[model samples]
Target: MNHETKRDVFEGLVEELANAYIALDGEGIGEELTNEEKQAYMKDYDAALPDDLPVIPELIGKYLIMRKHDRGDLVQALDEGTSFLLDGTQWESVQDWFWFSDVKDSVDTFARAWVLGVWRVEETGEIVKLEEEK
Candidate 1:
C-alpha cells in the first residue's frame, strides 16, 4: 500500500482496537492482550474487513534483511532494500535492530528480531518512507 493508505490502515487498526477493547465488556476497560487476541479483536472490531492481516512470519524476512545490512553486507541490503523495515521504531542505526530506547538504548538483537515494533499494529508491517520523511 501507499504511504497515506498504510497510515490510514494503521490508524484505523488502532482505532478499531481501541473500540474493541471498549466494547468487549461495555465498561470501557482496557486490558493486556496477547498479539493473537489483539488481532482477533481487530477483526470483530472492524467487521467489514474480515480479519485480513499479514502473517507474523513476514517480520522474519524484514529482520533478516536488517541483519544483513547490520553486518555490513551491502549487496544483500541493496537486494532487500525494496522490502525491509528501517524506521526508528524497528532499527536503531539503519544497520542495527534495537527494540527501542526505553532500556538505556541497549539492543537485544534477538529480542529486536522477535518482538517487532514499538507499536503493536505495525508490528509485522513494512516501513512506509514518505517523501516528507525521507
Candidate 2:
C-alpha cells in the first residue's frame, strides 16, 4: 500500500485506541487491570477489522504494533515464523515495550509499519513477509 493509505489506517487505529483508553481510564480499569483485561482492551480498541481499514473517529489510535514474528511470546506469529495480515497499518509493542521520550520515534514508526506488515529484523536469519488476503 502507499504511504498515505498506511498513514490513514494508522491514524484511525490511534483514534480508536484513544477512545478505548479514555473509556478504560474512565472505568478505572487501568488502575487495576489484569493482563487479560489489558490485552482485551488493547484488541478491542486497537485491533483493526478484517478489512485493512481502520475506523475513523474524532481521534485515532496511536500506539505501537510490534514485530509479529519475533523471538518472543508476545508475538506468536514471529515466534512461530508465520505470516499474518495486519488488517490495518500500524502496530504497537505487542509483547514488551518501554516508553522513553529521549530517543527518536522509531518505535512509533515501527509500530505503524507493523500494522502495514512491514518489519525489519537486524539479523537476517528467517524470512518474514506480507501476504495479502486472497
The true-structure Cα RMSD of candidate 1 reads 13.5
Off by over 4 Å in 1: 1-4, 24-33, 37-134
- Give the Cα error of residue 109 in candidate 1, in Å: 35
For candidate 1, write residues 1-134 as lDDT tens digits. Answer: 23233445567768767876876675655565679977865564443321222222334445544554366343444344334434433432333323332333323332343233211224545442212212
Backbone clash count for every predicted candidate, in the order shown: 0, 17
Cα lDDT for residue 3, model 1?
28
Candidate 1, lDDT over the whole model:
0.41
Candidate 2 ranges with C-alpha deviation above 4 Å: 1-103, 125-127
Per-residue accuracy of model 2 over 14-132 as CA lDDT, tens digit each: 77667667768554654444688667655554443333322211111122222332323324422332323355633343222223323245345444445655333323422133445
Candidate 1, clashing residue pairs? none
